[model samples]
Target: MKLAMKYIILYVNDFDKTMNFYKEILGLPVKMQHDTYVEFDTGATTLSINTRESIKEIIGLEMPASSVASQTFELGFVVEDVVATIEMLRGLDVPIYKEPVTKPWGQTVAYVTDPDGHYIEICSAME
Candidate 1:
């Protein structure tokens, strides 16, 4: 099947805080928004945030507990300068999971946790 669009929908407990993190902090442009949902334009894919209450209404089930330690996936972004990005995020008081460090594979990377405790990685472009 040919996929035309892609999106990662994160069910968050605090919708406004999560939305502001991606919009104001990360500088992602808003593609769509509502009282319960928001979609940000992230290059080829969209990063969407939906309230957990809305998800419960749609699916008729409660969402499971969310924790950064329990998350098995991360949202990754390729930046021109990992060090500068991490510093800027730090200045804004964003939680830094890992300081910028060069990996054995030659990529510089750092980790940050979003408002909802989702792991986000900033890294240099892969060679």
Candidate 2:
């Protein structure tokens, strides 16, 4: 038997907006995209955005109602300039869940939620 993990897919209501949020605002590279899907190369993992209805159809399950916990996954990405990145994202109208703070892990980090409500943490290792 073979067990391996693949990509994480986020069911977004608006695919384009979500894609733009990740690509333009978050600066993740878009590896592939179509009318219904967008895939990003997130270093160690691939992240995807697809329509909610399409995702439900694929999984043969009904979509859940939006809630504080519905979109609970926290996607972390390495960043060089935490403060500057937070400011740039703020300028683009992205919600800042938390501002940059030094963590015990020796990283300066900040948090933001995507259009679909998934938390994204940006961090830089302390020198």
Candidate that scores best on lDDT:
1
Alpha-carbon RMSD to native, per candidate: 1.8, 2.3
- Score candidate 2 by TM-score against the native: 0.84
Off by over 4 Å in 1: 1-5, 65-69
* Residue range 10-123, candidate 2, lDDT tens digits: 877776788788888777898988767788888767998888788677777776646343644688888889999899889989999999999887789999998877888888
Reference-based lDDT, each prediction: 0.89, 0.82
For residues 7-69, write the lDDT of model 1, one tens digit per residue.
989889887888889999999999998878888998898899888789888888788656443
Residue 78 of model 1, lDDT score: 95
lDDT, model 1: 0.89
Residue pairs in clash, model 2: none
Worst 10-residue stretch by lDDT in candidate 1?
A: 63-72
